[model samples]
Target chain A: MRLSYPTNIRIIKVPCTGRVAIIHLLKAFEKGADGVFVAGCLEGDCHYQSGNLRAKKRVAYARRLLASIGVDPERLAMYNLSAGMGPRFAEIAREMTAKIRELGPFLQPSGRTAAPQATAA
Target chain B: MIMAKAKPLEEILSYLEGFQRILVLGCNGCVAVCEAGGLKEAEVLASALRIQNMQAGDRRDIQELSLTRQCDKEYLAELKDKMDNYDAVVSLACGAGVQFMAEMYTEKPIFPGVDTCFIGVTEEQGVWTERCQACGQCILAETGGICPIMRCAKRMMNGPCGGSEKGKCEISVLVGRDVDCGWHLIFERLKKLGQIGRFAEPALDKDWTLSRDGGPRLIIREDVRP
Candidate 1:
């Protein structure tokens, strides 16, 4: 999905982005986010002090995993900004959308999405 | 910390393409803290997959469940009733979790959401480097806690391999230190413990049968199991 794709991009606001984990980013892609980015407070400026740094670390790890999985690591990103940085948030969105446009829609094997409905064991 | 990269997005995407519903499992242990697999990873992957499906115009239902620990039976037990609800179980835990989940449900396909890399330790914040081979032996008292099984170029038990170049192993540049071999780290540690002599003792071959050969391993506690 392109960042510009309607409702494709989601921003999950947490107590802090550091609360986000690498798998969360992966799941997003697995579920289908052409690109994902985490926007947190500026470095050394987290309201919770270490939260932004933590978010950065998590995003880094997620990007690495995305790259490993054949997903463009560029699909996932982290930015530092205050909660009120509307412009910064928009910038992230624009950047991500552009990246996704280049990568194209998530290409799954078989060009299918639905696995067989899970049957009760 | 093992430097395991996630399976490329294409690979993971392809695996889930045919599945209608997917459950992404997460472990809060090693992978969680390192930002690999954990609650956060489960949520993120779920979200990404959902978006992927949606944007692709696929109507698959991607579900999720994150447990505190996938390696532990007690922890996995939490999902007993919920296991059958999903088409596939995408375990964010290491490879063992995939097998465990597959074993538990026998019928459902279990997938390793996270590629379990190697036995490792955090070299720094969010940095994991492999340290152990888990050859079914515990000889850390000898090597100063540095695992030669993983650190040595040849997984040597005796000492530095002939290929060890200036403390660096021929296997990779990452395995060595400029002035100190990983062996040095182990020696220094043992020396501090006044256990340097223990390093000289030989290790008997570890019995592989004690591990996977035992057949489906089980640790049932009457108090916990019904």
Candidate 2:
């Protein structure tokens, strides 16, 4: 049971993954989260029957939405695991942190960090 | 409910390119039930637009508002006081609602955010099929409650022409499934009820004046008027 995740990773708990609406995920990105991932119960093992399944669909939709607006769809993800899989949870956290690191920091809305354009002499 | 589908983000973005501040309006009517232009959809759109503008290093103020019903004048009037806050309004209602908004707010630009599909019923959670064409005459009793005018590709009242085979309509091939022929469905339903003989009774020529052919027909009921 010796494991650690990135210091920057923050987790928000919901009653069920199905309760994680598409707007909630998008709000994370709008507020400048580099990446977001949903960890729900394993497929066919949802406590509320199809709650996890609904979360899967919502995650997919959020991915498409991000892609449609020119944002990288890879910024969002969905993972299914049983409640007892503590190792899997840590693994997912590590994976998401690594992916976000590779993607680098999200730029501010004021265009301050944009790439330098060459000017004619 | 009036079914509709969201317009592509690129198209919506293009429409808003000229404006810095915009209102992405939603309707809590048919579009709400269809999950097309509902409050959730409006919020999603607003967030997407914000993200888009943020990434592009530009400013876009998108206010999301969901009205009771955009098709109704009383509901649209609620926004009359605050209409000047934005440059234009992107309507997330059906075509009729969009047109009505345009008519109501003649001074402002109104853009449609969804494609009005059909007058239909939800078959399942995410599936909707056309049910009524508003053909102006009610013939559902004779057709076993299945409307051939809307279901049949040809709109044939007396149907199952040469295209019907194996209980599937000819156009089913193009639609990617074996759609049951309209008349075939009638025949089966009537046969089960021991009323198959009704199929032979020719339906008289329908009145075209009551339908769209009459040039945007209107109904005025003196009995209900105040």
Candidate 3:
């Protein structure tokens, strides 16, 4: 089923969410992504075992770092979903897109809207 | 190993205020092992700084470098050719490494990225406990390998003072964690070694001159001199 999600979202594939380090998430924001999210396998269902959990921790850390720099920590988030939940994946995409839209475009510390860049992982 | 923690981001940013081009330097020695100041940490800091700068509408040039060990002249020599590229450096090494780097490159400003905590051992993946004070005296033989200077909140020579309760030091309340009473550990260790008699022996006042109080101590090994 070709469930449609917001086209603004760009997904970068990795072998596992564990492979997504803090730098990767921060770099996305540094490059001007309005929002970023790590879509990992559902907790306890990670193919590589604990990859999703590791991603969860890293996402939390990155969020704190973002908040420290005055960025909206809500701009970065992590979600867990199984491979079979394509509809839920689409739903999450819509939900995040709406949230980001309501939060408006991410502004640099200078208060200027950042140039659009890839926004999800 | 030396244990350290990152300084607050605001403090580090303040150091970079006037410097447009910055180098975030890391040490692959003790700071690396403790997960405080290493190549990965350097990258994370660099990225965060970049994001902060971009948000502030400031175009700051930030780069990263990691030396095998910043305290060694041989390793610091690697920066000889790269020093001219940046106006200042943010070092993630321990205090000694930062000082050594600052001394070598006198023209540029060097700031510490992490606060050096203590000489410690990794109790677990993310837990580190202070183990030594480098007091210039070794008394592990008598104390059963437990150090009193660093562990005991009061630096008790003969202790388990009234402040010690349930094997924890009174200072533990202020630190928000249970700190093992140094004397309690000593007693237990000495008992295990069948040297409980050592506890009865009075300890003389520690020689303050043998410690940092003596001021910048030095050692000369003629046999190893080139």
lDDT by residue for model 1 (B10-75), tens: 667877767887887877776787777877667777766665565566888877778877777888
Off by over 4 Å in 1: A1-121, B1-5, B173-180, B184-226
Residue by residue across A1-121, what tens digits does model 3's lDDT show? 9899777777888888889999899888876788888888878887788888988999899989988887889888888887788898898888887888778777633444422233232
lDDT assessment of candidate 2 = 0.83
DockQ of 1: 0.23
Q: What is the lDDT, from 0 to 100, of the residue B112 in candidate 2?
A: 94
Better of 1 and 3 by DockQ: 3
TM-score of chain A of each: 0.77, 0.84, 0.88
Which candidate has the top score in TM-score?
Answer: 3
lDDT of 2 by residue, B10-97 (tens): 8998888789789999999999999999999999999888888878888778889999999889999999998989898999999989
Candidate lDDT values, in order: 0.65, 0.83, 0.87
lDDT (Cα, 0-100) at B173 in candidate 1: 50
Best by DockQ: 3
Q: What is every candidate's alpha-carbon RMSD to the true fold?
A: 8.8, 5.9, 2.2
> What TM-score does chain B alone reach in each candidate, compared with the true chain B?
0.77, 0.95, 0.96
Off by over 4 Å in 2: A1-3, A108-121
Worst 10 residues of 2 chain A by lDDT: A112-121
